[model samples]
Target chain A: MLERVDKAKKQIHNTVDALGRSVNIMEVCGTHTVAIFRSGIRSALPESVKLLSGPGCPVCVTDQGYIDTVMDLAAREDCLIATYGDMIRVPGKNGSLETMNRSNVHVVLSSDDAVQLACAHPDKTVVFVAVGFETTTPATAVAVMTAEKMDLSNFCILSAHKLVVPAMQALLSDTKNKIDAFLCPGHVSVIIGSDAYRPVVEQFSRPCVVAGFEPVQVMEGIAEICRQLADESPQVKSLYSAVVTAQGNTRAWELIEAYFEPYDGPWRGLGCIPNGTLRLKRQYKRFDALVRFGIEEIPKEEPNGCLCGQVLCGLINPPQCGLFDAVCTPDTPVGPCMVSSEGACSAWYKYGRRGKVHHD
Target chain B: MCLAVPARIVELMDDRGVADAMGNRWSVRTTLLPDVQVGDIVLIHAGFAIATVDEEEARKTWELFAEIAEFQERQAPSSKEEGTV
Candidate 1:
């Protein structure tokens, strides 16, 4: 594995040198962000090859108002919150779900558990905090389908679910950040397919390479991007074909189409993006938590001095934020970036703090 | 938030199946890939088998990595119209 990693590294350097210019490649998967840092690839790369982390972490990009709203739901006596573990520690306007220390809130591993909670408890309204990209969206859809099949009216989803392609499109259309190419999410590609990124590659003229989580896979993915730039060809290439395909999982997409619709969604720093958010379709509105509880999703600004938005856009690193380490450690994170394990800020805190980047 | 792992199916009944990743075991819904069998390996994401992994394709991907270097040396970038490394 080490030998193969070294071979890919040499190829990356050769390609970059041939191009005779520096390039910024963004890995648009939170898992890929952590993998890059953990594999020691960030520090091992040459100074000219800059790697930037994009808005791939669902927890990090979730709107602040949504956090406050979930906290509000947690405070209600008739409500029980079933959420993925990443969300419990994220701070909101008043406090976090974890700090409340209430028995009403429970961390669940899957949407299946959330539905089961609604079944087990006949009275309390069980609201699942659903947040993720396309890879996990179908799971929540399956949960909703199950609820409807079982005729369970007590279960609903407070969906902060986001789509990956639109977010990337929003980033490229904006002029501030300069990204040469993309290391697309492997699992996301498995669900959405490699062909989903064709618009980005064709419209924006950026190469998109899908990669797995291993060290060799990551290094080879970067090398592929560099080769594309050097060769002056931007195409959609799927390196992880064991699961990903040109068309992707059709059945999974069918489930998504049946349950959700596109709308303008709120993002922390990026603001509201058109067709960026997914909500339960009109037919499935009966299971919509926001509608059932009469909750409104008002946009809220980032906490005073939090740079999560800037970090999401690849404008700055986590350390560049004023509150990154001193005030926003994982134990007492001021922002979602530090709290989620797959977040870039959390990755830097755990593994990439000492790595040298192009900035250095 | 999208975390998925490859696990082999140990048991199957209709859409529901038990998947084993190494020593750990859990029930997974194979509704996406309804054709998946008890012994086939599939990628499990959030209690569902999203896609079946072809072990042959996985081995081929790594083998292609070795050809990447040769592909770089063989083809001249300016002359070619298309083909991935």
Candidate 2:
């Protein structure tokens, strides 16, 4: 295994040297960001090749308005909020769910746990704060289906599910961020498949390689991207083919299509992206929490001096932010990037990257 | 937060099943991959089986790695200590 990794490393260096120019590769997944840092891949890489973090963390990309809306729902007398642990510390307009001192909000591990919580509390309206990429959409879909099977009318979901491909498109269209290639999220590809990235590559003319979280797999993916760049051919390749297929899980696609439809949604750093959001279908309107509670969209207020927006766009690293370590530590995060474990800032903080110089 | 891991399905009951990974078990839903069965290794995310791991492909990847190691060994026959390679 180490021998193959050595070969891949050599190939990467040779390819980068052959290009004789700076190559910017953006890994659009928080997990990949953590893996790259954890494996010390950056230090091993040549100076010409750079890796940047993109808008992949669901908690980090969740708009402030959505967080405020969740806080509003939690404040209701008859409403109970169930969400993943990472969201508890993300600040809304007034405060976070943890600092709100509200007993109605509960941290859940899985969407099914939220369903079970709803089932237990038959009188109170339970709203599951669903947020993730395609990897987690199926779990939310299954939870909604389970709620329907058990006739749990009190249960509903406040979905902040964002599509990956649209966000990639948004990044490519922005002239400020020059991403030469992409290291696509492996788990998202497992559900959406490698073929889903073909459109992005075709339109933007950038190489996209689906990679696993392991160090070798990540190196191999980077090597493949470098190889494509050397040949001046931009294409979509899947190095994590052990699990990902061309069509992906057909049943997952069916379930997602059945319950949700594409809508324009807001991202924290990036503004409203057209058809980048997912909302419950008309038939499943009862399970939609936004409609059930009649919650209006609140105006978003960006955090003061927090460069998480810039960090998420691959324009800057976490250390580049003034408040990154001083005020935005994991314990007291001023931005969503420091709140979520998968977030780039949080990973950098936890993995001891504060004082070190970044390649970017 | 797309962090998924490989887990083996220990039990299957309709669309819901129990998947065990490294001594910890989770109640995972198999609705995404309805064709999955017991004892199958699946890639699970957020308490759901997203896809089944192809053992053959996994083996092939490992075999490629082994082939690379063998080629390196053939090139450096004098240094047969196996620590440097």
Candidate 1, Cα interface RMSD: 11.5
Per-residue alpha-carbon lDDT of model 2 for A116-228, expressed as tens digits?
99988999999999998898787888899989999899999999999999999998999998799999998899989899999899999999999887788999999999999
Runs in model 1 lying further than 4 Å from the true structure: A355-360, B55-85
lDDT of candidate 1 over A1-360, digit per residue (tens): 779888989999898888889989999888888778765788777778888888888899999999999999999999999998888888988778988999999888778889999999989999999998898788899999999999999999999889989999999999987889999998889999999999999899999999987778889999999999999999999888777899999999999999999899999888888899899999888899899988888989999999999999888888899998898887778988888878888878766665564443
Q: TM-scores of the first chain across all predictions?
A: 0.98, 0.97
Every model's Cα RMSD, please? 8.4, 7.8
Number of backbone clashes in candidate 2: 0
Per TM-score, the best of the predicted structures is 1
Model 2 chain B weakest 10-residue run by lDDT: B76-85
Task: Tell me the deviation in Å of residue A4 in model 2.
Answer: 1.5
> Which candidate achieves the best DockQ against the true structure?
2
Question: lDDT of all predictions, in order shown?
Answer: 0.85, 0.84
**lDDT of the structure predicted as candidate 1:** 0.85
Query: How well does candidate 1 score on lDDT at residue A86?
Result: 80
